[model samples]
Target: MSSPVILEDLQEAFPGWCIWRSSAGRLWATRNGRRLSQYEIDHGLCQTIDADDVAQLAEQLREQEAAERAL
Candidate 1:
């Protein structure tokens, strides 16, 4: 089931950062005056999900964190 993402999830995941939706409908996360996209961190930097993807990426992040803790 596909569901629409919400802004609150982004806030919860990135309490230290801020999420922005550009006019072109692109999502970005900014922290410490730096901004980047979810894809950039996920693929380019091989980094974990932050706030760029918000709920979309947050679910994956939460699941991954849970699995790692179980190990």
Candidate 2:
């Protein structure tokens, strides 16, 4: 219902990631540590992940996690 509450829920849903919603309503997520490598980028991982909503954002994050594990 509030910004801080929503942020806390997002953090719980996606631990260790930095999550935020933009002024226009797009949801963004990025890892807390080092950036993705060149090989990871070439293989489709992103430096900053964004989506129209939470579900899509979760999907992208899951893919990113899987890709990183594969590397």
Candidate 3:
């Protein structure tokens, strides 16, 4: 149920990632850098983050950011 305005907001908020809504209507976020290391993957980093709504996707992005900053 995301609108274009919300999508634009998400893109602006997550400059380091590519965010979009799939044709199927699912929200997706992919990091705009190299692939995650095995360690990062083991720690919870993902290549693609997805959610059913904007709020859920934002929460996932926040969590992903925290994970990247973690030692």
Steric clashes per prediction: 0, 0, 0
Error at 7, model 1, angstroms: 1.8
| TM-score: the better of candidates 1 and 2 | 2
lDDT of 3 by residue, 3-59 (tens): 334878888877889998999999999999788888899999999989999888888
How well is each residue in 4-29 modelled by candidate 1, as lDDT tens digits?
36766655654644556767765655
Where does candidate 1 clash, by residue pair?
none
lDDT of each: 0.50, 0.78, 0.85
Question: Which is better, 1 or 3, measured by lDDT?
Answer: 3
Better of 1 and 3 by TM-score: 3
Q: Over the stretch 1-71, how does candidate 2's per-residue lDDT look in tens digits?
A: 22223556767866768999999999999888878778889998788889888777777777888887888
Clashes of 3: 0
| Candidate achieving the largest TM-score | 3
